[model samples]
Structures are given as C-alpha cells and as structure tokens.
Target: MGARIERQKNILDYTLAALLRRKRKNAVLVLVYTLIVFLLASVVFFSRSLQREAADLLQGAPEMIVQRQVAGRHELIPLAYLEKIKKIRGVQAARGRLWGYYYDPVVGANYTLLVPESREVAPGTMAVGEGLARLRLSAVGDDIEFRTHDGSLKELKIARIFPAELGLVSSDLVLVAEEDFRGLFGMPRELVTDLAVQVRNPKELPTIAYKIAEALPDTRQILREEILRTYDAVFNWRGGILIAILSGSVLAFILLAWDKASGMSMEERREIGVLKAIGWETADVIQMKCWEGLAISLTAFLPGVLLAYAHVALTSAGLFEPVLKGWAVLYPHFSIKPYLDVSQVAALFFLAVVPYTVATIIPSWRAAIVDPDAVMR
Candidate 1:
C-alpha cells in the first residue's frame, strides 16, 4: 500500500514538474492536438448535419412528385393529369407545378427555375428562392428578371419566397402568377410540367407515385430517395472533397503534435530519469500523460468545434442559395441540433486523446525504464 501510494505521488509530482517546466512547448503541442481534433470533429459534425438536413428536406417534400421520363430524359407532363392523380385514393391535395431553369445575372448561372400551375395569375407575382434572394439582396416584391436557356427574358414581380434550409437545392427560384406565365412564354395553357402530391399517409407514397407513373405512361416521378440522391450528388460530393482537403491539414497537425510530444528535450529526459530512479513507475508516467492529452484535447477541441459551427452558419447565411444548383428555395439558416451525445464526444476522445496518450506512454515508459547512470552517461 505504501509503495503504491509513493509511486502515485511520484507520478503526480513528475508529471506536474514536466508540465510546468515545459509549459511553452507543451502548450504548443496541446494547441496543435486540439486543432486537429477540432477539425476532425467539425468534419464529422458538418457531414452529419448535411445528412440530417438533406434527410429532413426530403422528408418534408410532397410525399411524391411526378415528372415525365421520355427516352431517359425528364419531360414536362400535362396539367390535365393532376385531376386523374387527385382521384387516386390516399391523395389529399394534388397540384400541378412547372420545373425549369433561369439565369441570374447577379449569381451568373442558370439556376433551376420553378413556375406556377395557374397560367392566369402566375406572371406578375413570383416567388423567389431564399437562396437567390440573398445572392441578389432581393426580397418579396422585388422585380426579378431572368432569361431562360432558350434566350427569353421572363421578368416578373416577386410574389413570395421559398426557403432551402434542407437543400437550398438551387439558388435561383422564381414563382409567378400563372396568367403572366402564358404571356411571358407566349405559350398556351395546355402545357404543364410536374405534379406535386400530398398523401394521406406516407406509407402510401411509393404506391401512388408508381400508380401515377403507370397511368401517365410518359411521366417520371421524383421519389424521396431521388431527391436525397440529388442532394448527395451535389453537396455530398462537395462535402467529401472538402473533408479530404481538410483531412490533410488535420493529419499534418496531428503528426506534428505527436512528434513534439514524443521528442522531449535532454533536460526532460534527465528529469524523468531521475524521478524513475527515485521510484516512479510506468503507471505514474501514463496518468501524467493521460492528463496532458486530456488538457490538450479540451483546449483545442472546444474552440475548433465552435469555430467550425460559426463558419457553417456564416457561409450558409451568405451563400446557401447562390451555390445550390436546382433553383429550389431552402431555409436560409438552421441550427443543427448537434448530436453532442456522449458517444460522439467519447469517440472523439478515444480516437484522439487515447491514441495520443498511448503514443505518449511509449516514450514515457522508455524514459521511466532508463537506468539513471546510463541516461546520465
């Protein structure tokens, strides 16, 4: 009992002495470790946030949407089919919508465009996407003009705004009163684009979309998976690239920290060797290093994670709508109810601190085992 108590005291004493003596150097290692962990955490957090948001976005969309798939190309379906779709059981409200694209001079791209089903009133009152609005500093009632890919200017009054919080799927979204839609396009009311349906029960969604597809032979439906896959095609790919790039920087920092922690100076070697000679053991050495790893991780991770969250918030506030391609509106900003569950934090600790401390232990144990005479020599 006495020996164990003595050893524990020795470990605490040596560890404190080491920390105090190497404050500046140790501080740098801790900071670096913290930063690496922080970046990793942010990556994990953001990826999770993206997946969750994407899933939510898909979940909220019309239980099902149908478009025409012709020879592997999606073509617009006629509005006449909406009545047929409505007659189907489990369908609450079925509305005809037009999906297309528009070019925003401000954002400099052809964004996925949305028009109205009603040809009469849709011209003057347009609903701009929240994302496109931010890009142009536009708001409700602002006059927005865009040329279609075919070189026609369909300038219209902004009626309402759509939020793309989940997908912000596209940056340019313009909805107008349908009466104006006919006049703008110089086309008759016979043409329609897409069908959006709200189902009585979600379980009935796939069956309904499938039924619509069967009835309308030419129409293709946008299922929940399709929308999510689209999001993945865009954001997921981009997010992965970002993660890959950021991972390199994080890796570099981790290595730098590991090297620094492992490479104690001659003075530290001497001090540790003396402590060991005076009866310190491996347990004492490990506890001290574990504490060191804990301290460093906390210092780095807290600030790093906070900074990443801030970055996402600021970026989304400024650019969510402009960058997304579909022209769908998304919520401007949403706070991720971060899964700060114990498991997540614990995983981070296990991967970062535990490995770091384990790595630190190897050198610490070596130093502890050194014969004082040999080390002195």
Candidate 2:
C-alpha cells in the first residue's frame, strides 16, 4: 500500500511539474478551456434561471383571465367583470390588467409593456422595468414622455423602478396609477386589456374558469395557461440564442483537448517509453496523464465559474439582453442568485473535466506500451 501510494504521489507531482514547465503554452490552453467551460456553465445556469423565471411568472399570473375572443385583434375585457368573478365559488380576488407593447423612440427598441395604473397603483405614480428605464435615459423621478400609436401623448412621472423579475419575466413592465393610466391611454372604465383572477384553492382553478366561462358567455374566461403560450415562445427564443453562442466554445474545447493529448513531443515520447522500460506499468502511465488532465480541469474550473458569476454580478441582468447593456449601471448584475445543486455541479465536472482526462489517457497509454528502442530509433 505504501509503495502504491508513493507511485501515485510521484505521478501527480510529475504531471503537475510537466504542466508547469509549459505554463505559457498550457496557460493559453487552460484559459481557453476555462472560458469555454464558463460559457457552458453560464448557458446551463441561464437556461435554468429562465425556466424558473418563466414558471414563476406564469404560475403567479392570474388563475383565469377573461378576454374577448376575436380572430385577429386584441381583446379588451370589461373592467367591471372583476365584481362578477368575486362571486364565483373558488375565486379569492379579481382585478383588471392592461398590457401593450411600447416602442422606445429614443433608443429605437420595443418593449412588452404592462400598464397597471389603477387603484392598486399609488397615486401620481408609474413604474418601468430596468430595461426601459435605462434605454430611455429615465430614472426614478424622471419624467417620461411617450406618444402612442394612436397619437396619444403621455407625460408619465416615473415613481419607482423595480426589478420586474423575481424569478419571473424581466421584460419591460410599466405600472401607473389607474387615474393616471386613464389620462395616459385615454381608456374607459368598461374597457381593459385583460382580466386577472385569483383563486382560493389553486387546484380548483380549472373548474372555476369553466364555471366563470359558462356564467359569462359574452366574454371569454381563459386560464392563465392559455395566455402564457405567447410568452413561452419568447423564453424559447432567448434560450436558443444562448445555446447557439456556447455551442461553438464546446466544439472548440473538444478540438483543443484532442490536439493537446495527441501531439506529444519527441522527448516526451522517449521519456514515456523509458518509464515503461524501467517497469512503469501501462496503468501508471495512464494514471499520470489522468492526473495532468484532472489538474488542468480543476484549476480552470473554479476560476471560470467564479468569472461567470462575477460577470453576471457586474452586468446585472443586462448580460441576457446584450443590446441594452450599454445603459446598464453595472454591466452584469445578478438579481437572480444562482441556485447550485449537487447534481448540476457533478454533471458539469464530469462533462467538462473527466472526458478530457480520459482523452489524455489514450495517447499516454499508446506511448507507454511502445518499444523503447523503436521509439529512440
């Protein structure tokens, strides 16, 4: 046991020293590997975050929504429908909500807008998402002037800005008080873009929605699930883009790993053959090379992951949307804290590090088994 332990230690020490000797060259490879791993982790992390956010937003969304079903037009529900919904058996609360898309004329970008300027909103107040707030060069207490598609001019006072996402959609959310919303959009009391319903028992929501639909035949009472289909498409788009960007890095990593292990120098090959000639077993050679791979992966892994965390912390959520990052106070701010699970870390370590280590063993074994005289000749 002592002899075996000594040999393993020797292998580790030599493997580390060998990598250190080529620090400049190996550093470059490690740095690239680190970046690729970071990107991969970030993509996985970001995708997980997106899924959580989408689920939270969709689930927190009204259990049932009543809308006007028209073939090719936006449905405007009556504001008074909230009262009728309250009388339903399982309904806990009901409210009206307004949502629309706004074009940021100053920045030439569009926003998925939510206008909740009702009694629920504080007076003389409006809220905007961090996205629109920065893009428009507006902040808390900044006066925002927006002209609607229908030639309506709204001079909204920015009351407070909140992160629209708490594991939810962080899109362009704007909130204004009901009285101000009327002035801003020229909307009537009977008209609303959507009706939000809350239920006492969430499990009973489907039955309640059906009952509400039957009760209110004139207006359509749709579950939040149906309404979320449009938003689901948006999340898919964001995830796909992130994946495409990171896929390239993974491809590069496979090539780098292959080249590093395959192309051994003449001296290195001779050294390996000599080790074998002097009684180093094939397993020892493989183990030594595996140690090298493990060291590279481990050393790079933590730094790369922390680098990604730092980036997200510095940029905030702006990293997700590269377009508006310019106006971000911190380039990448991590409002959504990453939730680390043992399984994910294990999977990442296996995929990023273990495979490369195994790749290293293949070439090492080939060199170790070669005839020393033949290699020297």
Candidate 3:
C-alpha cells in the first residue's frame, strides 16, 4: 500500500514539473478555465440568492391578496368586499389595503405608495424607502411633492426613512396616510387597491382562495405561494436569458477544450513517448495525465467559486445585478447573503471539470499505447 502511494506521489510530482515547464500555456489555460467557471457560478449564485431573499421577505406577506378585476384589468376593490371575505369560514381576518404607484418624472422612476396596516402615519407626513430617498436626494424632515391626479402637487414631509435592510421590498416604497393616498389618487374613501387576507390554517389557503373567487366573481385571488413562484420564475427566466447570451462563449470554450483534449500537442506527444521509452507503463502515463488535469481543474474551480462568492455576497454581483434583478431604475442597493448549494456546485463541476478530465485521460491513453519511436518521429 505504501509503495502504491509513493508511486502516485511521484507521478503527481512529475505532473507538476511538466505543467511548470509550460508555464505560459498552462497559465493561459487556467485563466480561461477560471473565467468560465466564474461567469457560470456567478449567475447561479446570484439568481439563487435573490430567489432566497425574495422567499424570506415574502414569509411575512399576507396569506392572500384579493383584487377586483374590471374588464380583465385590476380595479379598485370596494371596502364592502372586505366584509364578504372576512365572513369566509377559514379566514382569520381580512382588511382593505390602500396602495398605488406614482411616476416621478423628475427621477424617471415609479414609487410605490402604500398605507401601513399596522401603524398610522400622522396626517401630512410619510415614510420613504432608502432607495427613494437616495434618488430624490431627500432625508427625514424633508418634503416630497407628488403630482396628484387633479394636476396639482401635494407635498408631504418625510417623517421617517425605512431601514436599509428592508430595501429589497421597500426600495421604491412610500408609506403614507390612507387619507393622503386616497386624495393623491382621487380614490373614493370606501374603496381600496386590494384586500389582504389571513387564514387560521395554512393548508386551507387554496380552498379559501377558491371560496373568495366564488363569492366575488369579479375578484382575483393571489396566494402568497403563487407570488413566491412568480418571483422564482422571473429570476429563472432572467438567468436563462443570461445563459443564452453567454452560450456562444461557452460553446467556444467547450470546442477549445475538446480540441485540446482530443489532440495532444506535438511536445506533449513527445513527452509521453519519452516517458514510455524510459519504462513508464501505460497506466502510469495515464495516471500522470489524470493528475495534471485534476491539478488544473481544482486550481481553476476553487478560486472561481471563491471569486463568485465574493462577487455576490460582498459586491452584490455588480456584473450581473442589472440584468438579473430587472430593476432599471430605483435599483435597490442590498447585499446578497452568501448561499451555497452542494448540488449546484456539483453540477458546475460536471459541466466544467469532469469533461475536461475525461478528455485529457482518453487522448493520453491513446498516445501512451502507441510505439514510442513512431510517436517521437
């Protein structure tokens, strides 16, 4: 056993020396390999992290949202609908929600206006999200003006700024008094943008949603799980777009790798011939090539993964954030919590590392079995 181990170590050492002999070539190969891994890993890490973030944020979301549909479009829901929904057997509570969007031509972005269900904002004052505050260059105690539906500007003082940690959900959010929201949008006092419903038992959500739909034929029931799924699907679709865009480069890399693996360079062929002539068996030659491939793969993969982790967790994936996040304006500035899935890493390994290793070994095996004189000439 010890003899076998010693022989393997010697082969690995020889592999290292051989790699070092072609420093420039190996360096370039490692760089390209690392870059491919980095790009692929970055996309996976960023998208999955965002998905997790969305899920975590939605955990506290209402079990169901009820919206009124008018001619197949969302319309204001009457407060009267709240009573009907609250009467549903499985419903723990139901309440009308006041919210809408305001377009700020000055900032070239839209702001979400909402009435806080749990707290009251004193009349004539509001709470703004960090992103909105940053865009408007305003802070607490500053007044922000919104163009009311009547072609008039209603100004409100920023009483508070939401904490940056909640930026994912609140980035473009503006919390205002219900009365102010109605006045800004010229909405009737007895109507709301939607209804938020809570349930006693979580499993009965779908049943309750169906009941709500049945009772209010003009209403649409959106469950929390469906919202989560929508977010997941959106991220996945965006990730797919990025992958499609990168496919050309990826294909090129694969072709390069295949060519490199299937056809050994003349120098490499000669080196294998010399080793065979010097009494190294076919298995030993194959083993050395296997070690070389593994060395290069590991050297590339580990750093690539580390770099990707840093890019997402530390830098918030600056390179791919714009495309993946889908927010062109009022882009929320938030850090992605580091998330690693073993399966994802393993998938990346099979895609990036395993093929190259196999390719390296096959060509080396073919060359190893040939007559040394023929190979040398």
Candidate 4:
C-alpha cells in the first residue's frame, strides 16, 4: 500500500510540473473550461433557487382556488360561487377573495390590489409592498392616489410597508380594505376576484376539486400542487432556453477537448517517449495523464461552482436574473438562499471531469503502446 501511494504521489508531482511547463496553453484551457462550467452552473443554480422560492411561498396558500371564466377569459366570481363551493362534501371552508391589478402611470408599473382575509385594513388606509414604497418614495401615513374605474382619483394613506424579505411575493402589492377594493375597481359587492377553498383532508384535494368543477361548470379549480408544478415547469423551460442559447460555448469546449484527445504536440510526444524510454510503463504514462486532466478539471470546476453560488445566493444571479425571473418593471430584490444538491454537482462533475480525463488517458495510452524509438523519430 505504501509503495502504491508513493508511486501515485510521484506521478502527480510530475503531472504538476508538466502542466506548469506549458502554463500558457493549460491556462487558456482552464479559463475556457471554467467559463463553460460557470455558465452551466449559473443556469442550474438560478432555476433551482427560483423553484424553491416558489414552493416555499406557496406553502401557506389555499388548497384550491376557484375562478370563473367568461368567454375563456377570467371574470369576477360571484359570492354565490362561495356558497356552492362550501356545499362540496370535502370542502372544510370556502370564502370569496378580492384582488385585481392597477397600472400606475406615474411609475409605469402595475400593482396588485388585494383584500386581506386574516387581517384588517382601514377603509381609508392601505399597506404597500417594499417595491412600491421605494418607487413612490412614500412612507407610512403618506397618501397615495389611485384613479378609480370611473376615472375618479381616490387617495389612501399608507398604513404600512411590507418587509423587504417578503418582496419575492409582495413586491408591487397593495393591501386594502374590501370596501376600498370594490370601490376602486367599481366591482359589485356581490362579486369577488375568486374563491379560496380549504379541504378537510389533504389527500382528498383532487376529489374535492373535481366535485367543485362538477358543481360549477363555468368555474376552474386550481390545485396547490398544480401551481407548484407550473412553477417548476416554467423555471425548467427558462433554464432549458438559456442552456440552448449557451450551447455554442459548450460545443466549442467539446471541440477543444476533442482536439486535445486527437493530437499531442511534438514536445508532448517527445516527453512521453522519453518517459517510456526511461523504463516507465504504458500504465504509468496513462496514470500520469489522468492526474494531469484531473488537476486541470479541479482547477476550473471549484472556482466555477463557488462563483456560481455567490452569483445566485448572494447577488441574485444578476447576469441572468431578467431572463430567468421574467420581465417586470417592479423587479423584486431578494437573496436566494443557497441550496446545493449533491446529485446535481456529481452529475456535473461526471459530465465535465470524467470525459476530459478519459479523453486525456486515451491519447496517452495510444502513444504509450508504440515503441519509444519509433515515437521519438
């Protein structure tokens, strides 16, 4: 065992020396390899982080949401629908929800208006999201005006500003009283944006949703799991698009790898020839090449992953944030909690490190199998 370990140590030392001998060439290779790894890691990390954020935010959401459709477009659901939903056997509770969108021309952005069910907002006061507060430069007790549906302006005092940590979901949100919501949108009291439903048993969510659909044919039931799945699909689709766009860079790296595998420089050939001539076996030469490949791969991959983590978890992936997060005027500012999956990193390692190592070994093995005199000539 000691002999084998010592042999490997010597081979690794030689590998490092050989790499340093061709520092310019290996440095360029490492730079390109690191760049490709960085791009791929950025996409993966950003997409996964967004998916996690969506799931975490939706954890406290209603089990099911019922929306009314008119001519294939969403319309205000009548409070009457709440009664119908409550009548469903598996439904534990059902209530009408008031919400809508308002475009603020001053900021050139849209804000979400909602009526809180668990808390109260005074009729003449409202709570605004951090993004809105920042945009309007407004503070608590400050009045902001909204033009009602009848082209009349209504002003409400800012009761509070939501915490910045909730910006992922609450950015551009405005929480108002039910009366205020109805008056501002000119909606009748008998109608609400939708119905939020809770099921008695979590496992019966699907059955409850089907029953709700049967009871209200004009209404669509959205399950919490379905919402989560939609978010996952959207993030995955966006990540796939980004990877596709960066495919050219990946191909370039592969070509560079292929070139390294297919041919060796005259100096490299002579070096290997000399090693074999000096009694080094073919296996030893191949092992040394493997060590060289591993050194370069580690040199590239470690920094790439570290940089990607910082970019996504600390800086919010500023490079690819817009593409992955979607277009929005009031973009939320929040940090993505760092998440690492061993399987994902392992897969990336195999995809990147293993192939290059194998490629390096194959060429060295091919050259090592030949007679030293002939190789030198």
Using all chains and alpha carbons, the TM-scores for the candidates as numbered come to 0.74, 0.75, 0.94, 0.96
Q: Residue 62: error of model 1 in Å?
A: 0.6
Model 1 lDDT tens row, 146-229: 554457775777666776552245435555665555555554576666778888887888888878777788777777777787
TM-score, candidate number 4: 0.96
Cα lDDT of model 4 by residue, 184-246, tens digit: 989998998999999889999989888888989999989999999999999999999999999
Task: Output the worst ten-in-a-row residue range by lDDT, candidate 1.
Answer: 317-326
- Compare the candidates by TM-score and give the number of the best one: 4
- Model 4 Cα displacement at 315 (Å)? 1.7
Report the Cα lDDT for residue 68, model 2: 62
Question: Per-residue lDDT for 1-377 in model 2, tens only?
Answer: 99989988988998888789988988988889888877766655655555555566677666777776677455777877777778888888887787766666677766655665344557566776776676677779898877844687767788877664521244466776666666556677788888877888878987987888787766676777765665556555666677676677678778977888667778888888888877777788889888988898888888877776665545443455562122432222326555555676678888888888888888878888777566456
**Candidate lDDT (C-alpha), each:** 0.65, 0.71, 0.90, 0.89
Clashing pairs in 4: none
Which regions of candidate 3 deviate over 4 angstroms? 371-377
